[model samples]
Target: MRVSSIYVDGYRRLTSQKINFEDGTTILAGANNSGKTSLIDLLRVVLGGDGNLRAEDLSASARFDWLMSLVDAAIEGEDCFRALLEDENVFEKVPSVVVRIEVGYDPDTDDIRQFADYLMDLDSEKSSFYFEFRFSSKRDGMIAAFSGLYSDIRKAVDDCNWRSANDAEPGSSVFLVLQAKVDAALVNCSKPEVFFSDESYSNVLPMSTDKSFKRLFNFRAVKASRALDDTSDDKSGELNQRLIAVAKEDKNWEGVISKLPSRVVEAIHDLDIRKLTTDETLRSLNTVIESISSTNGAKQNDLFLDFHVTEDHAVQMIARAMQTRYLGAGVPLSEASQGLGYSNLIFLHLEAESFIRSAAQEENRYLVNLVVLEEPESHMHPQMQSAFIKHLLSRVNEIGCLQAAVTTHSSEIVRLSGIEQLRVLKSEEAGCRIVDLRKFHTEEIADKPAETQRLFSFLYAINFSDLLFADRVIMYEGDTERMYFQALIKAHEELAGLRAQYISYIHVGGAYAHIYKPLVVDTLRLKTVIITDLDYEKESNLSSFEKLKPLLSTNATLNEFFQDGKKNSPPSVADLSSAISADTGVALVPDTELAAVAFQMQPEGYARTLEEAILATLLDAPVWTSLTKKKWKTFRNESGLKFSIPREPESPTITQIVASTSNQKTDFMYSLILNSNLVEAVPPYILSALRWLDS
Candidate 1:
């Protein structure tokens, strides 16, 4: 049976969360120290047969924080402890870690047709039965049953004229009687073997046995840091012990030992060690001991190591040191470069696959395997990471009743795998949220798998980790805008707190800025502003401007500012409004609108780009001179056009030169910012947007 979903409550960093598992594979991804490890470890702790929350599992800082919380609760009153017993919230909860696994029934059980009938006729809530288990700090379940007995004992105390103890149910001798009963139950309790079902439920019944549960659930964990000590003596020794156990179970070793060219097995068995242990060997040894004792004038004593065949037929069989030599290099594997790392990682996976396959065989039917891997791409290059993840997935598909969960930060692995396989773990103040991309897709685009693949391909090529964790994001046009914004933010002291808010500035090209609307604004649910330039191939056609006018007019908010008569006479100042789409959290704003708020150089204008807006705001003669001089020295000199520039640096000529440079204005902007000590004023529109984002 496979696990459909896991509901965890009061596990470290996981207050209350339900993480759904997709068939085949599920990847948990997040930033460092963001609780991805904790979530994975907790899953192993729950469904894993011997999983438990021990003190050593927690970090030092977490332990200290937990202690301080308890201190505060104690100072508050007894009500605080009682709240913990109730487990209503994170603070009040004891180790009330409850895990419920929704199990999917196997088809091979009972008759396939009968099972299908049973499933169809079962209750909606009862169809998918939950295997639930919980952890509590104190004995809780049996207390209700024993409370009546305690009350009776308290009343007996009152009748016996023990007035002082009679007033206190707890202080009376009743607790002694309770302890005796508990001890007696522990010593002699035996669970009864019986089955019960409601007569009304003819088609279906819920049943579980310890043997069946054990056979159907298994968990194995391979941590990223585990490869470092794979070749340790203790580990190899354990392998030897396991090998011996296998030999004893099936006598498979006899077949391997029989392959010797000569009679090696016969020669070894011909030692006659059994005959050497007879009474004659003992007498010979005793006579020699007596002769030595007579010569030394001392009494003889019997002290010797004994060798005897035990009742269980066990023999002492020791394995020699493990030696591995590289075939190509003819060198010891440990001495080869990165050989230890590769050997440990590769062999562990091989062993895991072997174990899984063996467990699923006919003789070992009903065994279910859950393999957990942490950073399978560790110490591997990009190509190897891609190959390993692909191979792992393929291998898992070939095995039956096997499920795997991997935690990774490798974007290459993510790209090689499908986007539908990702489960993003985003840490927040409340707790970590696990977002499955399959569940996060918008309803309108749910059926379009090709479009989803296209989007994943585009996002994979770019480094967009910042966007996944940001509170809000501004989507600008290109690198030029991005560079200037980065520099401007450094100089503006009023925008200091903005850095703490985790704001991201992305360079989404003008034509495709709206494509990211569903991802950043819909899936992530972040407030987003699109800063796009008005492009009219030529000022005469006005194709883009005409298209945008109608789209903006469709929104009630935008209609008030840029619809009807206002369209013909477009606002010279910045044009800002909410998007005309159904999503309310996103806004489609023009570069002109932002420029007007940042600088007063424009009234209402068209085709005014970001660079033109910045230049218009920095109208000072020296600032212009510095910018132009840098441009000529860096870019113009390479083009051999520096000699044509006038010494005075006039506005009309300089403006033409600045606008006519290469397509990318990076060299000029980088040189201008470095050469001049002047602080560029934060554009009014940019400042207004930042303020709005903060609010």
Candidate 2:
């Protein structure tokens, strides 16, 4: 049997979230504070973890409602309060942390008797059972005790108010004191309850105990803050203790233990320690001790010292002296001297081995084994992080019933794990939303197979999984645009807030920028700005000397953006340029508020690409003169080519100069950034896009 899915409600940030699991492994990935840890904690608690639920474990709204329910019940008098406390269906009415686990099994193969009592569904084809765990008040007089405490506090507050109003005495502080007492009493009465039920939870089976639930599922976790250090005396000592426990469990170690005493005694005898006692210095010391005893009138009480090595003592000594050492460096070094990364990796392997061994034991075997690894990428380099998931999966595959769930923030691990195994947790004001990418792709892109294939291929080729964790995204055309935008964001003060935000810049180019619309806007719901060039083509093969009348955009993204029911026809260049120049290129993505597109344009006319647009923008700035001088010196010195420097910014010679450097756009942009500050030379369209993203 395996856990197919988990539905959590009213648990710390997870108000009403359901997470689906892969049969083998599920990668829970999201940004910090997105309820990844809360989900893990929920799993642990529901699966018989020893942690007790406190008031803080409830969500902010749940906690408020719970307290308000008690307060309202108190205001209605003792009879109403008693009724509310005794109601068996109180959990359904009040907001409390509840988790429903759905476990799927093959009736033909699995042990039916283990989960026979939990089978609420009658259909033979149905292979899943549900178990609900919830927080509730203790029923054995604890509820009555809590009720009495709350009622007493309510009466005390009423009397205090009456006294203050009648006598004008200082009785206002009495309410705060009584409220603290009630809050403490509530914490003392809270407990967790477990029940068997159907999928919708309308049909609940007989009450279940925590021990029975523990027998069904086994859960273990490797927490993110492992506190793994080299000091053997610290928490690292747990490693030694675990080694000892595993060694004692092995049957072969019985014979080794029986022979240890004899081996220790034989080795000690070979050391010849009695020779030290026979030395002249020891003899003189013994003679002095005897004379002192005689002078004190002690006839047969002379004290003497001797060296002894009992077998039991030697065996105990050897056992306590055990230590871990690294022997690959030709000489052994203590574990304390090794690096933290290797130490953590070793610790992880040992933990997995221990859990596996425990689960495989005959008496401790469980129906399902769950091993959760939180932030396994800690202290690991990129290469190691990328490979750790596969290594862990291979190790856990030994047990056919085992399932591993890894929670990570590393993009390398996410990229390697693939989207099919991902459960992305997104934080919202109400709680969290868990997005299963497998279902998302199947439902959202079910009709568009070609686009689906193109999307996955593009994602895999660029390894753009890091965008999954960004606050927003900026998709640009090429390397030159990426380089210039990065430099500009860093150099300009107006864009300083963009630096604080986590923005992922992706190079999608003009042809495939539209391909990411579904994922960026629909799945991730990210605020996205796609910057593409308006590649204008000549109207009718006009001669270079003659003026070009009309132009058309060749960019697929812009064409699709402005496609007005026209087939095989791109948007006119004049219309696109007009929108860009007027700062009207921003359009909300269909059914989304966070995504838009920005294309290149010049105020007076159409500029073909980012390179031309930047040059045209810089024509009126002083930096343009500096760039011309630098371009002249660079070409003359590096290529031994002579060219006339353009004196007038509007001259056709300047346009020729911009066109000449098209082949080396990246290198030219790099040189331009290194020599001149282009903060004032930012193109209008690009500036609008950046400011929109910043806002």
- The TM-score that candidate 2 achieves is 0.78
Candidate 2: tens digits of C-alpha lDDT, residues 517-547? 7777777777899887667674433333123
State the weakest 10-residue window (summed lDDT) of model 1. 595-604
Residues 237-268 of candidate 1: C-alpha lDDT, one tens digit per residue: 43344344444334354565444323433444
Stretches of candidate 2 off by over 4 Å are: 65-93, 137-189, 231-235, 245-319, 364-366, 444-455, 540-551, 566-569, 574-585, 602-605, 620-656
Best by TM-score: 2
Candidate 1 contains a number of clashing pairs equal to: 12
**For model 2, what is the C-alpha lDDT against the true structure?**
0.69
Off by over 4 Å in 1: 54-95, 106-128, 137-214, 229-320, 328-336, 339-341, 363-365, 442-444, 448-474, 482-506, 525-607, 620-658, 662-664, 673-695
